[model samples]
Target: MKPNDLSTSSFIGWTCKLLAILIIVSLVVDCSSKKDVYYCPMHPHYTSDRPGNCPICNMDLVKKEDTSEHKDHSNASNSLQAAESISNEDHSSHLSETSSEKNSRELILSFEKQQSIGIKTELVSKRNLVKKISAYSSVAYDPELYSALSEYKEAVRSSEFLSPEIIRNLQLRLRQLGLSLDQIRIWTSGARDPSELILGGKSGRAHIYSQIYESDFTTVKVGLPIKFKTDVYPEKEFIGKIKSIDVILDKNNRTLRLRSEVSDPSQLLKPQMFGDTVIQVSLPNVLSVPTSAILDTGKQKIAYVQTAPDKFQAVSVQTGKNIEPWVEVLSGVQENQRVVTESTFLIDSEAKIRFGSDSHAH
Candidate 1:
């Protein structure tokens, strides 16, 4: 053989050997890829047939360590079956939770529907609301007060002939009849008689006889503003100050008798003039809503709160004193929220039908 022919044979042999090594490497890679199942550890539900990144978590797929080759075939089959059953159960539970959560947080009403239902809303306010307690009363002269004044005056006049002990006892008695030291001292020095005190004193004032219920007795105190309106004088509002509250309860009515002194400048509030009294009690700034916003189902007091422009949610609130058109909101709403004021009953009816949470029906 020539030298060129030998060199050609050597080149062909090296090429064949290189091709054989490449074929073995390709087979090994194919087998390894077939055994490997790639999955994202961050998203356990995601798996890929080939090694790739997870679509959801954007994390690199991790190769699951293969136990099928080392374990019994029957055991591998049983494990696969168990995993499938658990996965189905988990998927169903996840779907149920998603549906329930969606319903719980949302209640969508169209703007047109809201207008048709005559819905009206007002922003919850944190301001002073004068909690008013009401009671029907009659104006009358204070006889007991005048009688004590007379006895006190008589004791004072006879003090020159009477003992010092008698004078001290008389002073104590005047105090017991609800007279302050200033009142008795002023009465003694002044020229007003007992008859003038009974009918109409120099001030031409009268006392209002009222009953404060057990619930109101504790909250009411002297010096609170009082307003009285009689049927005869409809427009006139007689303002007064609470003078005294009886220590003993009225046995017949089971209420506390409260006496308020009203100066009758117009003399409209005369003796035996029947009137309704409203006591304005000042309270600290608290959360409040309109009285029309509340809907009581006997057991629960609910108010419709506007979570969105058209969507309203029914929330149970703890209520306190009522001041005419407004009421104290103790809880279940914030000061900045908007509450449905007018047509609240209609909103509540619809909400109950839609949400089906009328635990207290009838």
Candidate 2:
């Protein structure tokens, strides 16, 4: 073969090989550009070149179709419409829940039903509530008290021989027996016998002893008018003024001792005679509501207020002193507001039925 012909054959073979390699490279680049893109159905923004679960919602990733530009625009518009529809549906559901919750807080009663339930209301107002504290009483002839007073007197007389601590201890004993500091000072300073204070003195003034519960300690005062009626003299009423109240309460019975001086001119009153005593306590200018309006749930005090015509709402209240038929309102209802003074428990039951127990949790 000639040398030129051989060289031409080799050149032709190299050109064919180069054209094949160029075609193969173009095919690989086109296939890579057309690869499928995957995206999460629940979280559309999360996309990947391969199929897998979405990191956000753990939903399967779906393949995105490769379509014409116009088809892509159409799909985008459809997705937007679907998203808006879902948003509107969620907003409507929220509105429905809010309306349902609002309706649960109130209870309605018809006029006929109100009458049947004996429902009544009263205005919250400031008033002077008078409380009558009644307690058992007896004509004073305390032998233990007399002995303590006598020891104190004897100690004072022998002051030269008795240590100061001994005398002070005797005075403390008198105090423990229910004598106030002023009463002790008076008895110790005077030469008169202690019997004059316990029994009827020459002036026909007899001591009356009564006890009040610790619950009434705040309402009682030194000069409150007290009336005593004894079984011995059932027809007569003995009048007196509170002279002193014990500084300490009795630990066992939770009561405070009260001493009063009553006029017994007829000398009919005798020691240890059983009687009943009434003390008048006046609480002035305090905000209060009717006792029936308060429903004590043991854990909380609740009052029902008429918020609208035939509609009632439960409100929590803090209460103070209770003077029968009237109770002090520390908080919850405003003055002049109307509260259900009757059928409060029924209203509370209705509220619990309508709104569950949390309706009046405040």
Q: What total of clashing residue pairs does each candidate reach?
A: 0, 0
lDDT of 1 by residue, 95-199 (tens): 899766545534568989888989889988888766779987887666777777777788888889999998888888776655567656766876445554456
Name the runs in model 2 displaced over 4 angstroms: 1-104, 110-113, 189-192, 197-202
Which candidate has the highest lDDT of all? 2
Query: How much lDDT does candidate 1 score?
Result: 0.78
Ten contiguous residues with the weakest lDDT in model 2: 196-205
lDDT at 30, model 2: 79
Per-residue lDDT of model 2, residues 1-362, tens digit only: 99999999999999999999999999988777777789998889999999999999889999997777659888899999999999999999999898776655767888888888889998999998789999888888888888888888888999999999999898888777767788788767874467865665435666888999999998898889999999888899888899888888899999999988777888778888889999988889989998999988888888988888798878889999989889999999999999998888777877788778776765
| Deviation from native of the Cα of residue 68 in model 2, angstroms | 15
List candidate 1 stretches off by more than 4 Å.
Answer: 1-92, 95-105, 128-134, 141-200, 214-220, 227-239, 249-254, 264-273, 278-284, 358-362
Q: After aligning candidate 1 to the native by TM-score, how far in Å is the CA of 319 from where it should be?
A: 1.5
Clashing pairs in 1: none
Per-candidate TM vs. native? 0.58, 0.75
Scanning candidate 1 in windows of ten residues, the lowest lDDT window is 193-202
